[model samples]
Target: LTFDDCNKSDRAFVAGVLRKHGFGATFYVTEGLGFLRNKENYVTWEEIVELDRMGFEIGNHTRTHPHMPGLSPGEMRKELLHIEKRCKEHGIQKPTTFCYPGFGHSLSCVRELQRLNYLFARRGVGPEFKDGGRGGRGPAYDPGVDHPLLVPTTGYAGPDWKMKDLMWAVDQAREGRIAVLCYHGVPAREHPWVNCNPEDFRKHMDYLGEKNCTVISMSDLSLFVDPRKGPEDPYAPIRARMKREK
Candidate 1:
């Protein structure tokens, strides 16, 4: 499980629930999206440190959340490095995982993450499934076939996502495939589009627990797949999957 955008509810609500069930998740942090100015909706650096202390993986979501495809390599580097610098100052270990801001990524972004030595990165399901806006379905991560930098999200929680969708996503975690899930605030106030209702979030977590799913952080993937290895043609698996679906 992965939570994005440094939502304050992560500290207030999400952490307690995860702790209660002994589940592991990654909380991707960033200073953008009025995070510094809007404490009501976002988490503070101190709270971010507390999250790291809680043993949840803290991954980089860039300094300012921007569409990565729109930025030059230098700009992207700067954005990522700024977060790394902050993590250092706060005594949080350098993040080995990254999430593309707004799910906007490109080969340039992929190369930049590789240069930074990120072990894994997550992107929205696309080029196979049409962009689902905020929450939608996509292929599970097949490490043997997909690029580590282009790991696809099996599901993202939003207004459109439901319990059935969550079940379908988790079901894909078999035969060496991983179902990577993305979520925002349990009750994301500022970003209503990606908001997951608190009740629904609890139900989802409960379901995972009941089913005995081995929920893991993004960094945990390294234990199963070598980060340095990637398919010869990154998009080939996606194309083949699309053809099979058709």
Candidate 2:
């Protein structure tokens, strides 16, 4: 399971819940807002450091959480670099995984992320790069079959998500496939679009425990992913085809 946005209150809340069950999650931090405390009840740099010490994986969610598709290559690079720098300054380990801000990404940014040595990047459920835009939910992730940069999530856990939806996604995880679940906040109203009620959140965690699901951090999943595989650019072949016609 993965939590995004790095909410301050959720930090302790989530950690307590997971620790009780002996599970851990990857908290995707946006250091720009975190350092500035721009979001109400957002985690501070010190708290982020504490999260790491508590045995949770702190993954990068960019510096400012910009709409990735709209960022120029330079801006995108800065987003990752700045967060990496901030995390390092606070003695946090350099994050090897990234979660797309607002579930948004540009195909161009994929190569840049690879250049930066990010082990993997997560996107919401969808056929990756569909119609040249990003979006997709998954049945389960087979690392050998999925692109490293465009890893598919099972789905987002928000007001619209029912327990059945989560159970279905978890059921998809058997046979060496991974179910990557995304959540924003617990009792999350700060960002209504991605909020999950605390009670509902517990139920999901309890379910995982009851079923004996192997909850893992993104970096844990990275061990099985082959970075050298997949299209360097999904469009590369298309671009080559165009060149031939030209």
Candidate 3:
């Protein structure tokens, strides 16, 4: 499981609930989305440190959360480096995992992440699964088939996501496949499109706990798969899937 943005609820509400269930998750932090000016909606750097101390992985979501495809390579590097510098200042480990802001990604961004030595990077479900707009569904991460830098989100819990959608995502986690779920704030006020109610979030967590699912943070994937290994052609799996589907 992964929570995106620097939502204040991450420390206040989400962490406590996950602790209760003994589940591990990643919190992708960024100063973007008015995080610096808005204390009510976003978390402070100190709160982010507290999250790291709680043993949760703090992944990079860039500094400004720009549409990655539009940024020049140099611009992208700056956005990523700013977050890395901040994490170090707060004593958080240099993030080995990254999530594309707005789910906007490109081949250049993937190569950039690789250059920075990111072990894993998460992208929203797309191409493989026709994007259903906000909170879309997509295929599970098959390490053998998909590039580590192009890890696909199995489910994104936005307003449209329900218990049924959650069930479908988890059900896909079997054999050699892993389901990766993305979520914004629990009751994301500013971003209504990606908002997930606290009650609904709890229900989803409870379901995962009840079913004995092995929930893990994005960085935890290194335990099972070597980040150094991936398809020689990073886009090969995507093209293959697209062709097969067609």
Top candidate on TM-score is 3
lDDT of 2 by residue, 61-148 (tens): 9988888999998999999998899888999899999999877766877878888988888876644323212212453666655667
Q: After superposition, how far is residue 24 of candidate 2 from its true place, in Å?
A: 2.4
Supply the global lDDT for candidate 1. Answer: 0.92
Q: What is the lDDT of residue 193 in candidate 3?
A: 85
Error of 2 at 2 (Å): 1.0
Q: Please identify model 2 stretches exceeding 4 Å from their true place.
A: 32-35, 38-40, 127-139, 232-246
Native-vs-model 2 lDDT? 0.76
lDDT sort, best first: 3, 1, 2
Give the per-residue lDDT digits (tens) of candidate 1, residues 20-41: 9999999999999979899999
User: Which residue pairs collide, candidate 3?
Assistant: none
Tens digits of per-residue lDDT for model 3 on 1-246? 999998889999999999999999999999999798999999999999999999999999999999999999999999999999999998999999999998899999999998999999999898789776668788899988899999999999886778899999999998899999999989787888888999999999999999999999999999988999999888898899888988
Report the error of model 1 at residue 168, Å.
Answer: 0.5
TM-score each candidate: 0.97, 0.86, 0.98
